[model samples]
Target: MNFHRTEVRHRAVARLRAGAKNADVAREFDIPLGTISYWRHMDRAKRGECPGAHDPKCPRCDGRELDSAAYSYLLALYLGDGHIIQYSAHRVPSLMITCDDAWPGLMNACETAMRKVFPDNSVCRVRKTGCHNVKVYSKHLWCMFPQHGEGKKHERSLVLEPWQQQIVDAHPWQFIRGLIHSDGCRITNWTTRRVGGERKRYEYPRYFFTNTSTDIIQLCTDTLDRVGVEWKPARQKSRKAENISVARKASVALMDQHIGPKY
Candidate 1:
């Protein structure tokens, strides 16, 4: 395969930093073993450290303590509309959460969550085709959130680790709120009814969450159940995705008490 020098170097650096053997990296990247050795030497020399002799407590690269609320929010954003990308040219992986350009509040929440997760890293906003994005770069971020992977989320098996599940269990409301804010919406729904002798329209508020991943939908429903908010599942018009609706007056009221509506 034809590969750019920069791309090869980037891959080499990432693998080395992740503690892969030179032979393993060469085999994985399909590069010459000697070339891999040379890259490793150059990388270590640039850092002025011998191979495998780097400090584990390097302030910039060490993992941070997980903030359950912040991480749960970030996780929902990720499962809903966020993706992680690692390019051969970039030193650190990037976590990006894309929101509708019109929803500035949602965008701000995403940025805040990322900053809370990686307090030392800078979060930046970028304008994309029809949405705005909040992004942060950190080498250790992916270790904490290992859900990052290839292919569409629905096509993959989504499961939370034991530690992550514990966080969700302790802060299910925050988790549900994040999921709802990202993939769900609150709207005023109406129905026409006959009262006394005249036909009248009655309006009620409801929440609807739609997503392509069944596992994610199940997670939302399970969390709502745990929080005592009632909901019902429905198939989306496309048939490719599914949704859950919380429309019962009492149920909506309960959700309002817990998740509420994202501003």
Candidate 2:
């Protein structure tokens, strides 16, 4: 401990007391982590600080004003294709959403929504073989995303909390948009038809949302019904999964106005 200057120790302790992580303080001050932890413990003891201090950044924990629209959309994204990972070395959990490499706009939208949901945290993008994972770290992820649990999401119950349901109900379109950006697609279907005794080609655009969880599919269909969008359960030809289709011209138009194709 004496190897480090007294001023460095003071600075490290100050940062540690101000809610900075021991690892961050150690790296910033070029001090061993064990020494930093000891110094932090001493500083906390001397100041009579509580050991179990709750973070005020959490809306559920601290009564902060949650961004309902952003949270609703993010909730849909999480339920659709996102996941929260708790690392062994990290006390906080990370929220991650996989975005297709082809849709740069969709990736930007996901990152923006995450930032809006957690303005104080840093968001990062990790590159994969053909996609990018946008992630943000937070201590109260389970509080925010109560739907997170062990095993795949399709296997567990995904009942939304009362507050979360309120947000979704208030911003149904945004929720639908996020879900579409995650696991839904807008495609054009075409077929040949006889018109006026001649062969003619006809094409139509529609939206399809596919998920392995029946609960999530039901949520999507419920929202669609709430918004007066006609939808039907679609059958998969090559896979066993639940899918919802918005094929009616009016419904497609409504979806286009509110939640268009992923970027």
Candidate 3:
């Protein structure tokens, strides 16, 4: 069997992504037409666009039962620190979430949720200076993440569809966990007190979620309320209502049990 070098194959795929016809790419690269077609097929399969062989069987497209728990969690991650890039008809879109490298477990969980949500698609991680980009390319991402739009997440009007709302209701903790992993954190505040003639340090743990999108913030707080977890507006130095706090002892305990620290 004849084989092309890695660089040649990459150029061929780049041509395909640029809307060049298979035969044209084959002619330009001196590759067999059938081989070019196979390459195209494999690329589409990796993106979950191929049917039967590797299709993701998108719930919205094929009426498959959506993995509600995973979908809810991924949705929170997308809302918090992710973005979807729209592509032309010839190419598939990509979903990317930036995860801190310090929390390798969070990166793994994020990739796991993506795989569960888009079962047949391949997820990849790209490393940055201090973080990793967990990404998946698929034609059906927009169908699943309907909140994807033209601009930044906070700049756009975010609303949940009825079906998505149902999932959030069912797996509120999972959703909260994803959001915390993406844009929230659990921190400890300590103070030294004199007890029995000795200085003792007491630590208080709390959860905080910060987001500029009012709608997303509302969604998080609403889910917190549904689960009987209390939260309040967290005032920052800016004095804006973009921060949320779960500081009550009981609420913090619940968060710790369900979400915990990033790692």
Work out the TM-score per prediction. 0.78, 0.81, 0.79
Q: On a 0 to 100 scale, what is the lDDT of residue 164 in model 2?
A: 87
Give residue 69's error in model 3 in angstroms.
0.8
lDDT of each: 0.82, 0.86, 0.88
Name the regions of candidate 3 deviating beyond 4 angstroms. Answer: 1-54, 191-201, 239-241
Better of 1 and 2 by TM-score: 2
TM-score of 1: 0.78
Candidate number achieving the greatest TM-score relative to the actual structure? 2
Model 1: how far residue 262 lies from native, Å:
3.2
Q: After superposition, how far is residue 224 of candidate 1 from its true place, in Å?
A: 0.7
- Cα lDDT tens digits for candidate 1, 39-112: 78767856878755433222224543667788888888888988888765434678888888877788888888
Top candidate when judged by lDDT against the true structure: 3
Report the error of model 3 at residue 7, Å: 28
Tens-digit lDDT track of model 3 for 1-263: 46577788889999998999999999999999987897899788778787766555789889987789999999999998898875444457899999988999999999999988888788999989999999999888888889988877778899999989999999999999988998899999788999999999999998999988889999999999999899998777554448999999999988888889988
- Residue 183 CA displacement from its true place in model 1, Å: 1.3
